[model samples]
Target: MVQVAGMNSMWSLILQGDAMTKCILIFLVGMSVLCWSIALYKLVLFSIKNKQLNQVVQELQSVQDFKNLFAVAKKHAKTLPGYFLSQSLRHFKELLLLKKSGKQEYAQGAGIDFLQMQMNQSIDEILHQEESHVSTLSLFAAVSPLLGLLGTVWGLVHSFLSISQKQSADIVTVAPGIAEALITTIAGLLIAIPALMLYSFVSSKVREIEFQLYILSDKMITIARKVIVEDLISVEFDENFMHDQLDRE
Candidate 1:
């Protein structure tokens, strides 16, 4: 009689353990699907953005007139790096006006000068715009692993309590909770790994764009100084604007 009772209890424990393993498998599959979907979407978006930006940079280097620059950028705004181009055009317009007024020094100056300071400020602003929404990827990557750890701890606690009540050290009594705990840990890695990869990819993309922006700013300053030195044009508003702005300094 005693042997039969022990065998029946073991069978019951085995059935419970099997059900818990199924639950863990289902949880892992669902979590993996969600993480992969997000990563794929971001990958497509970044790839398209980078390709279009290269084309826009090529067009920018070839343009000589402001009207032509604006026309090219506007036509490709939907697919190209329109935001940075738009910003550079606005700054160029300001510099052109300063050159017309013979205040070229105010429009293009040395690294430690006021005009150079303005260029740095513009670079910062453009970089900030490019980096928008990237922090979300970093946040998700950081939180997923911790969430997995939490689930692992919860499963272990439940398994120990079950073993105490059953008064036996059988795998049948403990396997379910242990499997569920491992499922959470695996789920967390599924969420974290790809997210970190995407974050690094996007970060590098932003840095490349920033380097281009800085180089373009320096080129604009050099071009303005050259035109002024050669007497190509005299700016009408140069006297009043330069004196007013510089006097405030």
Candidate 2:
């Protein structure tokens, strides 16, 4: 009778251990699926953006009218960078209008300067938009391991509680709580690591495209300045020539 009771107790302990391990396994698998899906989605999105960015730059170079640029941006506004590009284009148009109207005081000399400032602002805004959801990835990655640690702590607490109640301790009695505690911690880390990796990779790609955009923006400003200076020079020459003609007459 004593031997049978001991065997039954041991068997019950084993069953409990198995159940805890299975629960942890299920939790880890679910977390892995969620994290991996997020990573893969981000990967595809960034990849598409990187490719489209080249096309966008090319389109900007060929664009003679700001209106066309706005239209293009509107068409692709669902994309991460597209709305930002649209905002920049709209701002550029406003600057062009200011130049044409020459309404404000100091509009002539400071026209290009104001446009440059607007350009810089627009770039900053675009970068902010691109970086919007990226921080979430980093947060999840950093938090995962801590979650795993929480599981471990919980398991330890449960183990102590079990020992106190039963007045006996063994691997069979202690391992279940430890295993359950570990499930969440492992799940957290499994969820977090890939998210961080994907965030880093995508951020690099975004920065590269941003660099190209800055270069292109600079080139555009230079061209605009040259055009304005040449126009001013031509006006000065025409006025001088007309004055001479009048004096001769």
Candidate 3:
């Protein structure tokens, strides 16, 4: 009941603010709404993706063969790690086909470097795509307070002008202006604090996701290397059979 009264009083103060103060308050409210909406969206998205990534990581840990890894990758095809895994596997298959056809040597030398570069490029693209809209939160957090301060200053200036015009310094004349100034100031802080906090939290989550991507990249490279090494050994031991099998596929 007490809290309800306090909220009502705050709303009353907001309603009594002058035109410029009202505009500033409205803008602050809109910014707060957007900030919270984005924050909730990003938080939920990150949570779900993080869970998917952990699942992929667990599957990767138990995967003993390329076939099993490929299956795991396909299962989580919508996730970041799954996307990377699938792309890397596709590139590996292409390189293997080229090697078997005697058109490219992917198991060693410059071929391996090229494959690594392609996989890294794919990882970078996915990372960029996953990090969208993070900057908007930071922008709202940083700008809201300054806008609120502008409103407060505007209110104070108007208050001073009103006092000068009246040729008197009375509490009744000064109170409204002071109220407007305080309202704008409070409105600004209300928008800024949560925005700033969410921005920090979201940024840290993004960084953690990025770090997981790097780990995924390393794991993918390791798997690719192992597959290529085994394939190279098999081809060396039975070039004709391997070429025939690859050609038939």
Candidate 4:
């Protein structure tokens, strides 16, 4: 009840503040709203992607060859890692087609290079998709404190202005205006602290996801190289195939 009355008093003070102070407060409020919205959405998205990546690799133990890997990825096409593997396999298929067509240029190592480029492009697209809206959190964290300082300075100006208008240097005349100005500083700190935390958490999660994807990509490329350079798939694709394939490299 006391907190409620204090909030009511604060609101009344805010309403009595000058136009510039009100505008600054309103902008701060908007920034907090946007920051929270993006933070919540990204947190949920990162959580899902992280969980999917955690299990996707274990599922690979059941895969036999590139074809089997592609099929498993197809089953999980909705997941981030699944999409990555499928895209990588699609590019690998093109390379294989060119290689089998007896194209001299492809046999000269151009197809492998093309596959590498395509895999890199695929990784970048997915990472960018996950990294969206994270920078906005950083922006809010960096700007909110400065806005608060600006409010603090403006509040001091308000205090002096009040004294000049009243033609008396009385504490009671200037205190209200000064306190209102200081509210902006407090508001700025509140937003900045949480924004910074969210930025750090989300960015760290993205890096972790990227690391997992890189591990997957390296394994996939190794398999592709062996298949293209040595023709391993022509041998056997039993349950022991991937275990042997990965173990050798």
Which predicted model would earn the best TM-score? 4
Pairs with backbone N, CA or C atoms under 3 Å apart (clashes), candidate 1: 100-234, 100-235, 101-235, 101-238
Q: If both were scored by lDDT, which would come out higher, candidate 3 or candidate 4?
A: 4
lDDT of 1 by residue, 50-98 (tens): 6776676677676654445556646664443565444444555566666
For model 2, name the residue pairs that clash: 148-185, 151-181
Clashing pairs in 4: none
User: 8-93 in candidate 4: lDDT tens per residue?
Assistant: 98898889878888888899999999999998998888889888887887777665467667666667766788777766766776
Can you give the lDDT of residue 43 in candidate 1?
Answer: 58
User: Candidate 4 — which residues are off by over 4 angstroms?
Assistant: 1-8, 62-64, 103-110, 234-249
User: Over all chains combined, what TM-score does candidate 2 have?
Assistant: 0.64
Clashes per prediction?
Answer: 4, 2, 0, 0
Sequence-dependent TM-score of model 1: 0.67
TM-score of 3: 0.84
The 10 consecutive residues of candidate 3 with the worst lDDT sum are 233-242
Best by lDDT, which number?
Answer: 4
TM, every model = 0.67, 0.64, 0.84, 0.84
Predictions in order: lDDT:
0.61, 0.60, 0.74, 0.79
Assess the local accuracy of residue 167 in candidate 3 as a C-alpha lDDT between 0 and 100: 91
- Candidate 2 accuracy as lDDT: 0.60
